[model samples]
Target chain A: MQLKTQTRPKVISVLVMEDRIDAATAIQFKERMRDVTKDAPARVVLDLARVQFLDSSGLGAIVAVKKLLGPDRALELSSLTPTVEKVFRLTRMDTVFTIHPSLEVAVASAASV
Target chain B: MPPQPVSDHDPRRSSLTLVFQADPVSIRQALQGMLTCPPLSCLRGEDRGMAELVLAEVLNNVAEHAYAEAGGKVEIRLDGDPRGLRCLVVDEGREMPGGQLPEGRLPCGPYVALDDLPEGGFGWHLIRSLCADLAYARVDGQNRLAFVLATGS
Candidate 1:
């Protein structure tokens, strides 16, 4: 999966350019995310506005990515589609990560810091 | 995983039973069929997400655990209407890890420590939480799991 990254002073935003994150793509997604996030800022937001479907594997992969980023860096999630958002809530992962309604909102919050 | 032809119709409650090879590609086809099924076509928003998520978890589990990297058959039966949905999944493979379904529990979450947070083991929890009723049974060398989600009625 191809990912787009935008760097700023406060946070680096990675846009996931896929519609579905399932068992079929979860591994690749995580691997690609690692490459994109290697040199990112401490605060990173995964913009998932385009993704409309997510399964448990996808959720686990995201959590793995967060752990890989280490303790100091925070991996935030933004622009979660309703379907993707439900997975986070049902699994209670919503509490684990800082979630935002949109990429702009997450970026704005980080910029203000 | 093997391919088996499915009849377009099943007489029981207008149910549809589709047998798929226990793999990611076949799982995706089954999911696509559910998303477009006439009875479930109206599913949108939270309901749609729940169905897709639960289905994926169950099917993937069969592919990952039951089959254990071997070829197998996964059967998915759907009986749903405007009010609710009942999903039955059957797999011809090894029994559950301990010959039982994973007891669903809320994961320790919203934690400050990364080590404390869990990455996997959330699938069964979500399945139990979203489905109004869930049951699992092994019959005649087949693993059967039934899930009911009440959309309105």
Candidate 2:
């Protein structure tokens, strides 16, 4: 699995290419993001188009990253699969963060800000 | 103690129990059974959604991550009480991940700030939000995960 990070202006967009996110990789994921964006004000866009499944641990890691961001920055989500999307909707997380249909829109919105 | 009132009954006594392999399909079936209490057929939309999402995540963790691809047996026991549903997942796998919060301070929900955009931490948040209690332990190379949710008051 590859987590590619790109910085455009103030935006940091990440593409996740793993079929599933669960306990096995949740911590690794948290560490990578924490290490990559250390103290940076990044409008992160997580592209989950390739993620076929997402378990609770994976969701926790995402929340952890959101916590790390604090009160100033923006954490955007994009390309959530239907099953994955169902999870967010079921948990009412769709109301918590900014979700986008595509990475381009996420980046464009970040750029506009 | 003297004979207790029916209203004071412990829901644990009414709980249903079952065991299954640590597979996604089996887990799904078990959850279906847990959510639907006989005469009720299947659970309603809300309860079914919660049960499916929570079980899918927990069981997937057991089958794929906890074992780390090494084949092993996982035992699941479920109890449905008037208080709510409780589940225990027992597995002889690698050491369990030390992911537990102190007492009642379980952290649940996504972070709003952009700077805190955690590149990955979101799974536990989902679990915490869906269930009333979640506990974990590693004993003699066995991982035991217990979760509980409350029903009507």
Using lDDT, give the best candidate's number.
Answer: 1
List candidate 2 stretches off by more than 4 Å.
B1-55, B60-72, B75-153
Instruction: Give the per-residue lDDT of model 2 (tens digit) for B1-153.
Output: 998764534444454556676665566566557656521122444554555566666676677677775556777666655456777778886665444432322233455444433343344555666787688887787888898854442
Model 1 has an lDDT value of 0.83
Where does candidate 1 stray beyond 4 Å? B1-14
Which lDDT tens digits does candidate 1 get at residues B84-103?
A: 78889999889887877888
> Which window of 10 residues has the lowest lDDT sum in candidate 2 chain A?
A17-26
lDDT of 2: 0.67
User: What TM-score does candidate 1 get on C-alpha atoms?
Assistant: 0.90
lDDT score of residue A85 within candidate 1: 85
lDDT of 2 at A33: 76
The TM-score between candidate 2 and the true structure equals: 0.52
Cα lDDT listed for each candidate? 0.83, 0.67
Across residues A1-113, which tens digit of lDDT does each residue of candidate 1 receive? 87889999979999988888888889999999899889888899999999999888888899989998998888999998888888888887888889999999999999888
